[model samples]
Target: MREEYELEVLERYDVEVRSTRRIRGAFFCDTDRGTMLLKETALSGRRALLLYRALSRLEQKGNVKVDTPVFTEDGELLVSSAEGSVYMLKKWYQGRECDIRQEGELARAAKELALLHLELADSAEWSGGAKTGIGANDSTVPGGVLPVGRNPLDEIRRHNRELKKVRSFVRGRVAKNEFEYLFLDSFGKMFRIAEAVAARMENSGCMKLFSESCRRRDLVHGDYNYHNILMTKEGPAITNFEHMHVDIQAGDLYYLTRKAMEKNHWKQKTGQLIVDSYEKARRLSDAEREYLALCLAYPEKYWKTASSYYHSNKAWLPEKCVEKLKLAVRQTDEKYDFLAKTFGLIL
Candidate 1:
C-alpha cells in the first residue's frame, strides 16, 4: 500500500503515517498513532487475525496493555485485499531492551515477569491461547491407544550407536596428534558424565520431583529473554507476548537465567541481583527452586558434551566452521560455569 493509503487508514484514528517498512510481510510504520506495527501475511493471515482478536479481547478486559488498532469502516481488525495479503496494525511500544549485563536489569525484568504472572492468575483463561507440552513420545493425542512403535530406551541406544560412528570418523580423520587425542578424551568424559546424570535421575526419584514441580501450570512468557523486555524510564515494559503459554513458572526462570549466563553477566553481583529480585517477587517454594537447579543442570551436561564432540571434530571440517564452533564451545563452557555457580551446583 502507498503512504497515502496507510495515512488514510490511520485517519480513522486521527493519526498520520510517518514511515513504513515491510517486516516479515507486515508493514511496521512510524506514525502519529505512536509507532504502528502492521502485519500482512498470505498463508498465516487467518491465524494472525485470530491473534489480533485475542489481543483485542485482552486489551478490553484490562488483562494486557496492548495497542488496540482502529478498525476500518467495515469494523474489522484485518483487511484482506484481492492480492490475498491480510493487513493488521497495532500501536508500537517505545523503550530500550534491557541488557542482561546491566546490574539491575535482570532483577527488574524478573519482577515484571512475576507481576505479569500474578495478573494472569486473576483470570482463569487468556484470550491468546495455551500450549500443550507434547513431545514425540507423548501418547495422549488422538491415536494414543496404539502400542509404542519405538521405546525411548531403544531410541537412546540407536543414538549411542550413531555417536560411536561419528566418533570413529572424527578419530580417523582428525585425531593424529596429542591435541586431538586430548580433545577426544575430554569429549568422551563429558559424554560419560551426561549419561551418568541421566541414569542417576532415572533411578533416583528425581523424575518424581520433576513431575510434581512441572504440575503447576500458569501463564508464562515462554521466551522471556532480556531482548524481549523493554527498559523504560518508568520501569521495565514487556513486549512480544506472542510466545506466551501455560507452563511451569520455573521454566521461564530457567530460560532467562540460562540466557543471561550465556552473555557472561551471570557471574557478577548484578546477575545475582536479578535472580534474588525475581525470587523476592515470585517467592518460589524451596522445592521449586531445587527443581530449577536440576533443570538447569541437565542443559549444561548436554551442551558440554555436545560442544566437546563438535569442536573436536571441527578440526577436520572447514576452517570457518571450526572457528565458529570453537567460539560456541567457549561460550557454552562459560555459561555452564556461571549457572553452576549461581545455583550452587558444582558438578
Candidate 2:
C-alpha cells in the first residue's frame, strides 16, 4: 500500500501509528497503544456493522481471543478509506498456531474448541427482555427458526452429478496432459465411491440431524482448522470470525478432527484421542455420533480436487494437481478403513 493511503486509513483508528508492515493482505500497525491489524474491505455499512456487533458480542462474553472490530471516534466499527473502500482495525496478537502433531497441543486444542462451541451455543440463548448476548432476544434473526428447508442428501446428489459431468468432460478432451491421464485413471474409482456415498446419504435419514442442530442455535466457526487457532500462553485463542455462521456444530468438530486425522495418516488412535478429549467437554449424543460418521464417510476432498480443476481457467493442467490426486486417493483409502473400524459400516 502507498504511504499516503496508509496514513489516511490510520486516521480512522484512535491510535498513533509508529510504524507499519504488510502481512497476509492486512497491514500490521505498530501504535503507541500496541500492535493492530488494518485491512481494506468492500463491505457495505449495514453488513459490516452486523458482523462487527456479532464479533464484539462474542469477545465481550469472555471469548477475548476473538478480535472485535475497533470503534471509531464517531462510534462506527467501519472506517471509510480512499476510493470509498471501508476498513476495520483489530488489535494484533502474537502467538504460534497450535501444532497437531504433538498430542499435548492436539488434546488441548480439542478441549478449547469444545469450550468455544459451548460459548457460541449459549450466546444464542434468550432469557426474556433484551439480554447481554448476541441477538439473544431477537426472534427475527432467522437463527432461532428451525432449519428444515433443505435436505442434506440433496447436496450429496448434486456433487455426485458434478463429479460425473467433470469426469465425462475430461474423457472427451482429444489431447490431454499427464495430469488428465492420471485423473482419468482414478476417475472411475472416485466416481463410483461418490455414487455409493450419495446412496448411503439418502438412506441415512439425516435431515432431522441438521434441523435439530439449527433449532438449538449451535453456531459453527465456518472455517475451523489449526491455522485459525493460535497457541498462546493463555491456551488456544481462536481468531478470524469472518466465516462464523449458524450451522450444525458437529460439522466444526468433524473438520478439526479430520484435519488432525489426515495429518496422522487416518489412524484410529488419533481420532479416538480427539473425540475422547472433546467428549470430556461436551459429550456427543448417539445421533450426533452417527451424523459425524456419515460426514466423515463422504469423499469431499476428492470431489473438491476434481471440481477445482474443472472450474478454474486452464490451458493445461498443472503437475501438482495430479500429485494432489495421488495423495487424495491414498488418504481416501485410509479414511475408509478408519470409518469402517469405528462405525462398523461400509464407507
Candidate 3:
C-alpha cells in the first residue's frame, strides 16, 4: 500500500523505477537512468525552480555535487500525490551521512562547504544582480534572482528578545524544575555574553559586509549541517539546497563549526582545524572573521534550551533538557577559550 501510494506520485516522473526501499522517511528508488529519492516537500514550485537553477549552475562549476531536483513530465518541479501531498524527486547518490565524530570527515565537510559557497556567490553574480531581502514577496522579485538572508545582527537582536521573554516566564513560575534552576543560574552570564556579542557586532564592520554581500547577492547554504552533507567515494556531496539563500556565507561556516565542535566537546584543536580547512580553500574577510567569533561566543545553545523549556508544558520537564542546559553552561567556558586562542578575541 505504501509503495503504491508513493509510486502514484513518482509516476509523474519519466524514470523507470526498478526497485524501491524506504530510508528514514524518504523512499530510495533505483531507476533505469540512475538513483533518485522521492520525498514529500512543502516547497513551492517557483522556489524549487529557483533552487534547481542555482544548483545546476553549481554542477557546471564542477566544484560541488548536489542532488539536483528533477522536473516532472508536466514540467513541474513538484507533483501532487493522489492524497494531495506534494513530492519532489532528486537525483540521489549512494553514500552515508558525513560522520562528524571523525575529524578528517569534518574537515572535508568544512572545505566542501567553502567551495560550495564560492560557487553560489559566483552564480549569484552571473544571475545579473541582487533582489530584495529574504522572505520578501517572491512575486515582487524578478525571476532567476537569489534572495538575501536576514542580517545576523537583526537575528541576534531577535534571539536576545526571545531569551529575555523566556527569562521572564521562568522567573514568574512559582515551582521551577532543575532545568529552570540551571537556566536561571546561567541566564545572567549567558545573557551578558549575548548582549556583548550583539554590541560588538553593531560596532564592527559586519553590517557593512552584509550590505555589500546583499548587493552582490552572496549566497549561503542556509542549513549547512552534517545531515545535509554526504560522504561519497568521489568526495563530499552537499545536498538539501531547499534552504539556500544569499548571505555573508560565513554564517554557513559558523554553523558547520558549531555543530562539529558540539560533537567534539568544544575542543580548541577541532574548532581551529575546521577554520583552517575552510581558509585553505577561501580566506575569510576580517568582518567575516569577527562575525564568526561573535557567533561562536554567543550562548546559542543555552538560549535554545531555555526557550524550549519555557514553551513546553511546565508540569513535567524532560531530564535531557536539564542535561543539555548543564552541557551548554559547561561547554561555554571551553568555547570562550577557543575564541580567545583562535580569533584573538579575549572575551
Candidate 4:
C-alpha cells in the first residue's frame, strides 16, 4: 500500500519525496513542496474526492487554513489504487493543538467556532455534507422527546429494564467483593437519576421546549475538543470537520463543556473559561443557558453510555474511570443547583 501510494504521488507531482511516516492511518511526508499529509482510507474514491473538494472550497472561502491537495493530471482529487485504498495529499499547516489552559485560548476557540457555525448556517452553496456530532436524542430514553422507533416510551421502559438488570449484576458482584461498594453505590445513584429524568421527560412539557429549540439549527462542529483546534500565530484555526453536522448550537456547547470538564489537567475553572468565552462570543439567550444547565444536570445519560461501553468489553478499566463518573455525578448535582438558582427556575 505504501509503495503504491508513493508511486502514485511520484507519477502525479513529479516532485522528489524525502521521507514518509505514518500517523493515524495518514502518511506525513517531506517532499519538495514541503510537509504533505496524505490520508489513505478504504472509503470510496468518490467520497474522498468529495471531502477534498469541500476542503478546497472552505480554503478558498478563507473559512479554513489547510494544505490544498495536489490533484492528479486527470483532475481527480482522489486516486484509487488497485489495492482498494483511496489516497490524497494535503498541505500540512504547522501548529500545535491549542492548550486549554492558555490565556484567552478558550475564548478565541469559542469565537472561532461561532464564526464557523455562522459561515455554514443557511449557505446553500456550502453543501459539503451532513454534520457529524452527537445529538440530544442519542442518549434520550428510547421513547423520550425525540422518536427512536414506533413508540418512544416503550424504548425508555426497555432501557429501564436494562438498568434494573445492571443494578442486580452490580449487587451480586459487590456481594462477592468483586466490585467496590462505592462503585455500586455510585451506579445506583446514577440509575435513579436516569429513571427520574426519563419519567420527567415522559410526563413533562419539556418536549415543547426541545422542539422549539431544534428549529434553530446551525452548522456545529459536533466534536469541538481542544485537540481539533490549532493555535496558530494568526489565531485559533479550526480543523477536523469529521464530526461537523447541522444541529442545535447547544449540542456544540454541551459537548465542548463536557469535554473540558472531563480533562484531568485542567482545573474546574477551565470549564468556566470555556462557558464564559462561548457566552461572550455567541451571546446565548437566558433560555439557551438554562437548556445547557438542564443537559449538564443529567450526568446519568453519560454514565449509562459509558457503562454500556465498559460492559460491552468486560475489560478492566482504570480506577480513574470510576472516579471520573463519581465526580461527574457530584458535579452534575452542584451544577443543577447553580443553574436553577441563576435562572430562578426553582425559586
Q: What's the lDDT of the predicted structure labeled candidate 1?
A: 0.54
Per-residue lDDT tens digits for candidate 1, residues 59-117, read 66663454455565566666655444455566656677789877678778877777666
* Decoy 1 TM-score against native: 0.64
Better of 2 and 3 by lDDT: 3
Give one digit per residue, the lDDT tens place, for model 3 in 209-287: 8877776667788999999998989999998887777778899999999988988988888998899999999999899
Better model by lDDT, 2 or 4? Answer: 2
Off by over 4 Å in 2: 1-3, 126-151
Stretches of candidate 3 off by over 4 Å are 125-140
Cα RMSD for candidates in order = 7.1, 4.0, 2.3, 6.8
Better of 1 and 4 by TM-score: 4
Ranking by TM-score: 3, 2, 4, 1
CA lDDT, every model vs. true structure? 0.54, 0.72, 0.83, 0.57
Question: In candidate 1, what residue range of length 10 has the lowest lDDT sum?
Answer: 143-152
Model 4, 159-234: lDDT tens per residue?
Answer: 6677667667666653333334554656766667667656655664445445443333244556787877878886
Q: List TM-scores for all candidates, in order.
A: 0.64, 0.87, 0.94, 0.70
RMSD of candidate 2 to true structure, Å: 4.0
Top model number, TM-score:
3
Taking the tens digit of each residue's C-alpha lDDT, what string does model 2 give over 178-281?
76777788887887887887777666646676665555556667678888878888777777666665566777888888888878989888887888888889
